[model samples]
Target: MSYINPVLPGTNPDPSVCRVGSTFYLATSSFEYFPGVPLYRSDDLVSWEQIGHCFNRESQLDLSDTDTSGGIYAPTLRYHDGTFYLVTTDVGGQGNVLLTAADPAGEWSEPTQLDVPGFDPDLFFDGDTAYLSYAHGPTLAETTIKQATVNPDTGDVGEPSELWRGIEGTFAEAPHLYRVDGTYYLLTAEGGTHLNHMVVAARSDDPTGPFEACPTNPILSHRGHPMQSIKATGHGDLVDAPDGTWWLVFLGIRQQGGHPGWHQLGRETFLAPVEWVDGWPVVNGGELITPRMTVDSLPGDGSAPDRAAPARATLATFDDETLDVAFEHRRNPDESAYSLTEPPGSLTLRGRTESLGDSGATFVGRRQAHFDCRIDTRFTFDPAEGAEAGLALVADERHHYEIGVTRIDGTTVAIVRLRIGDATETVVETPVDGPEHSVRVDATAEEYRLSYLQGDKDYPEAVGTASSKYLSTEVTGNFTGVYIGPYATTGEDATSPASFDYFTYEPTADE
Candidate 1:
């Protein structure tokens, strides 16, 4: 059966997976977004559903003031006995942390800060002995795959020992250790997470390896293939199925536009079949991955009972008892900034004095999973003098394109604003009469079209456009993708709040 490359799409990078019984569980890097380390469960490897986040409470994760792409790094999910352990690095916070849960879908315990000094921590248990391996050093070029004996229950780690520095590559990170039969295979991603990203392997008889590099060192990569649609293919974890088949789940970015084009959806989770050949695992018959591929060894009847449709869409009315798991806040958001019960059926966002250009901004958004998509929202915001509220396509604080309503020069106006780097501009503005307004943003691989409804008219008037490439990681130099949702900001002494009636997101057919 053929399955999509990104089984879990949109901003899900540095994937780590573990299998227990007939089910597979996966986790990925969240990076500066609240409720960090998204978790997923799958019956079939191709179809996954979000169970919950590993760090759902503010007490578990404090992303406040963390730099862009600096909060959560690579997470390794492993299951031992009946307990599940999740270990990861908070690049700009409390360093490495360990958390466990009896149920992956239930609330996880608060973090236990590991005394390790590295990123991408992986936990491996051989019977009762626990081992922790990670890419350690002060910088990428100096990184070495290191392992140490660990007490999983108390988070006490013993002295570390050096493992392999990657073969013919730099930035050795994202290490996962597995004992296949009697050999300990160490898999690590090297050459950074860009065009040169790659997955390399080594093997040793001991967990603290004086190991031998695989003859085919880079078992998986798309390093030199700039023209391929799938880019930055690395950071992989191996999972063994109950059918005795092996698979590798990795992170890759899907490029749009032209050669070495821009990717605005961030790094997504991709899968490939693995076969053991002469004691070493070969990924997808030693070939790079693509968006569509056939996995003959996939489990189940090629059907996912609860899997989302190919073209995913969502319509949220903010009438639910709590926000959907799909929605996330920027940093540790002011909980008081948002309300679903204030005005009964509407989602109210109290404007913060903080602008979208800073952390703690009053913004809640979902990852932009599709290149060709449309977002339509109806909102009412009586801006206090210089306040503004509306929909936004956000890459980061400094890079975003927004269309909303604001009061400028005492006139209530609908405006389209573009913020790239240090330059911010209101590209289009038109006077509107009422507080209630409907806005729309249509996104393609190349650009975003901004429009708004005029009065009681059925059609929307065009309000300029912004280059999607400018919002890409290639230009923004961030580790995240585009997020589209509602936002609001207030000036001093502002009293009014922006209340959103409904939000609709649809992946449209390409033009």
Candidate 2:
């Protein structure tokens, strides 16, 4: 009953796990992935369900014209004192913003920006003083670690002082500071976040001081790839299991080919045991843990190891809402920008701007990765002449591809095109599948292939090489993640508004 693969499927990266009581909560930095800061709750660290999102409205975080990597970056979710704090760096030129809520499942407060200079921030609270530990931008030569006091009331960062810088080019990023048994332990992600990624630790008597690196520097690493289920292991947060055992949860990439960068399987969440031997934390035999078929222990409910269909996975079920976690924005969107209630299950993506480059369309997208996926759309493409209703593999304005029913002339035409940055290349153009018809876009990732669904089957006989290349965190400039979404575009060429009867995304059960 486990997901067996991709629990947080399709570009759910930068996962930060926080266990509130017996309920385990996980949040990922949803760069342009809208409804920013996706929050999922699971009784067990495994089996999870999407309870809500952090940015519920546009006013909180804007996403209009936001390029590929423009939105939110690495976020740290922590339960301090009594409130749940979700801190993130909005690379969208908005600086860093922190939002808080009394309950993880309740309404969250608006984000308060910090004049801070770095990204991927983690907060530490001690008594009345709060410290924010983060390091991203270039260091003073060594890896830079900055520590600053955070205001509890406004979530504003105070004057920051330079903490220790790692000697290696690798900086102390994703730093988590905690005090245990009279010592301040700083747990940080080292070796960068890419290839050499690993969890490193150091301890200091003071919150800010000359720290001593752990003898076992890399407390955890996924370097061993006998079958390499977790790759690029780093950026971790520590937690105490219900049984009182200490553990660390971190994100790692799972690569298929040793060649690297064929198809980024993705950065997945992984947990490892932490042994505190003589004040130094040793993780999984002093090396990163290898992937396992299943976690041995049960989750909070004490359920058996997953006979449940999908653990910690987000399921839309064509429900009342479009599974908020599965959405993103051009610029930040206001509640009025889109609607899930009007047609209920049918997501009506109102057009924000006209041009394809900057227009804010309510594109409910998922990551474009699948050995096989079936996405059927019953959309009414009756908008102004140029408005578009189609499914897209959106990386950015520059790098994107889509096949959809666009209202052309007096009728709807099926258009296929590829856009990489400012330049666009049209794959082909066909007159409609017929007016107001059911069009589906099916993409298979095996050979990095994609195709359009013509009727009940993969459509029009066009299969493009399936590549997750454009979706790479390296190529696409935006901090935002890429998604495969069904979009409705409105421009000056439009006549009336279009509404979709429904859009269903169901990957092959085994995919």
Provide the TM-score for each candidate, comma-separated: 0.96, 0.85
Deviation of model 2 at 324, angstroms: 4.7
Model 2 TM-score is 0.85
For model 2, residues 350-397, the per-residue Cα lDDT tens digits are: 654543445455466665434356666665555557777667766666
Give the lowest summed-lDDT range of ten residues in model 1: 303-312
RMSD of each: 2.0, 3.6
Q: Which pairs clash inside model 1?
A: none
Candidates in order have lDDT scores of: 0.87, 0.65
Model 1, 26-131: lDDT tens per residue?
9999999988888888877877878889998989988886999899999999988899999999887989889999999998999999998988999999878999
Residue 493 of candidate 1: its Cα lDDT?
Answer: 30
User: Model 2 residue 262 lDDT?
Assistant: 36
| C-alpha lDDT (0 to 100) for residue 205 of candidate 2 | 90
Rate residue 163 of model 2 by lDDT.
73
Q: State the RMSD for candidate 1.
A: 2.0
